[model samples]
Target: METTAPIVDRWGGGTCPFDAGWKKVMMWSFIITDGLLFAGFLGGYGYARTMATVWPDQSTVFTLPFIAAMTFVLISSSATMASAVWSAQHGQRAVAVRYVWLTLVGAVLFLGMQAYEWTHLIEAGATLSGNPWGDALFGAYFFVTTGFHGSHVLIGAIVLLVLGINLARGRSTTENVEMAGLYWHFVDLVWVFIFTCFYLL
Candidate 1:
């Protein structure tokens, strides 16, 4: 009788098919799902815009210079987040902590500017139901999309604060800093899309 060979389990418990850490994999999964959520929101906004008899003129409804400043701050935060990750990877914990704090400051500034913008719009009669702008759906879509993105920024800010403290205390790892960078970059990318499709187009 011929002896049978035992088969090897290539994907056993110790294996990672993607060759990435569990934290990175989980963060990527979250990013993908969250990206799809934004895509759906933008798609609906586009459709509603085309169907509406009157969509607000972006120039008339938005302060381009102010929006540009907000964009600059968020993009700067992405850079600082990247620096933090790089510093952590290089074992420069003190520098990493400083970068994390800088990124957090950028987030706070962006949120403050956004709040000021929202207050100005609301005072001008912009709301979920209607607005002084051309189309009513315009107000609904604008608030919903931007608000959702702002909520993500807020969450990112909180995470950054925790990560900063942990880094300073020697409780955080390079991988943890990298994951936070991934999240911050995703938020920045999403804002670019929103700025283009919603504000520019």
Candidate 2:
């Protein structure tokens, strides 16, 4: 009998020459797939905006300052997530837990800002069907895309919270923290694109 190498070595113990842990490998795979999906969304948004005869000015319709603040908070959270992973890798469990908690706080603030924005927009006559703004599509796409992104943020926060709890209890490893960081970083990166595509240009 002869040993054979598996086509894909997701876990160790196979004949695969290169093997990152399963969690790390899966996280990268997920981020790549998710990135493509966001690309399609942003591409469609760009195409639609381009095809429109009279595209409304994004700045005019959305004048809130909090969204920009939210971006800053999200970017800051990415830093905290990186620190959490680094601390975990170094066996600084307490520091890792604190950093993860900070990241969750950032997420909560971002969600609060989004809720305010949504409420303000709805009060100002923006809806799924239309808006008082020059182009109705602006409101529709803005809500759909932003709401979608918000949902991802919400999910990421919840996952991070769980990872923090597990790490605190010694139920997980540094690899778990690193994997969670990958997902959080991916979500943050996607928001950057979403912000640019849907808000700035």
Candidate 3:
């Protein structure tokens, strides 16, 4: 068996041990694990939908145009997040702060839309304990998936706020900004799937 030696480089000439690159890798690993968990949940959702005597019509049960607008907001936020990362990397702190603010605004808007949707659904007689749409399965899946995604979005927003404060105080480094961006991007990616599966399909 062969052993590999640890790589080293001169100080300031190589990437720091706590660099953006390493943080991005860790974020990717986290996203991959999260994706697997979501996949299983979605598969189970699909199975339940198929097995149910009456599958809820997504188009009828969900407000399509409203969700579509929310989707657009999230996707645009992803773009802003990318710009923030770029600005941070290039040492443009002001631009980075602006982009982070925009991203945070987008997150707030998305959450508001989700709240509206939840309220509307409840008004229409959907409940976690007793589903009014099709069956208990319908309500169960609806709450579990959307609720999980909403929780992620909430966490992402909090992370963005923290990063924003750090940037404003000149305490945030490029690596910190990049790590936050990575987490934000993952949240957006998960929502894309959720929108497609829950609303469009």
Candidate 4:
């Protein structure tokens, strides 16, 4: 048997908590803070919906099948992003790049579908101020919530494009792909909330 002195001072400079890299820690921090921001948005939307004298019926306003397709595309992108990270970790740079590209394509397709949906709504007189539907706040909340989520998807697409290029050029690391995947997956998860709260409710 060997005797050892009691250890203290977990914050010793040389060690990382949970064995996570600085980049991963930072990404998680960003995800948490960003998630809070979305939570606030949804909270406000929920309160408004409950208080309104007349909330628009979601089914009458949206093409559920088309939105479901968009959701499917976004979820598929998350899977491709996970594949990219896995491939990068396994030293399959070419496969990683390909997966990243596939994920980007899915993001683009989702955005395009969103754009079409928005255009149709606007043409039907939906605006940030009001809509032909019931509650005026319906239009406002719908645009703001989905717009914020769409902007995140757009940013994820840009990041994936740059990541794919760097990966192909041998300038990207497994950690880089992993970070992008984390962000992309967060974007997808947020959409699930938005879809359920705004579209399905």
- Backbone N/Cα/C clashes per model: 0, 0, 0, 0
> Which pairs clash in model 4?
none
Index of the highest-TM-score prediction: 4
Error of 2 at 105 (Å): 0.3
Q: Which of the predicted structures, 2 or 4, would earn the higher TM-score when compared with the native?
A: 4
Q: How well is each residue in 1-201 modelled by candidate 1, as lDDT tens digits?
A: 133221223354556777899999999999999999999999999899889898888898889999999999999999999999999899899999999999999999999999999999999899998988788888888899999999999999999999999889999889999999999999999999999998888
Cα deviation at 35, candidate 2, in Å, is 1.4
Positional deviation of residue 133's Cα in model 1 after best superposition, in angstroms: 1.6
> Worst lDDT window (10 residues) for model 1?
1-10
Tens digits of per-residue lDDT for model 3 on 138-162? 8877888888888999999999999
- Runs with alpha carbons beyond 4 Å of true place in candidate 1: 1-14
TM-scores for the candidates: 0.93, 0.88, 0.87, 0.94
Pairs of residues clashing in candidate 1: none
CA RMSD per model (angstroms): 3.7, 3.9, 4.3, 2.7
Model 2: per-residue lDDT, tens digit, 166-196? Answer: 9889998888889888888888999989878
Off by over 4 Å in 4: 1-9
Model 4 Cα shift for residue 78 (angstroms): 0.4
lDDT of 1: 0.92
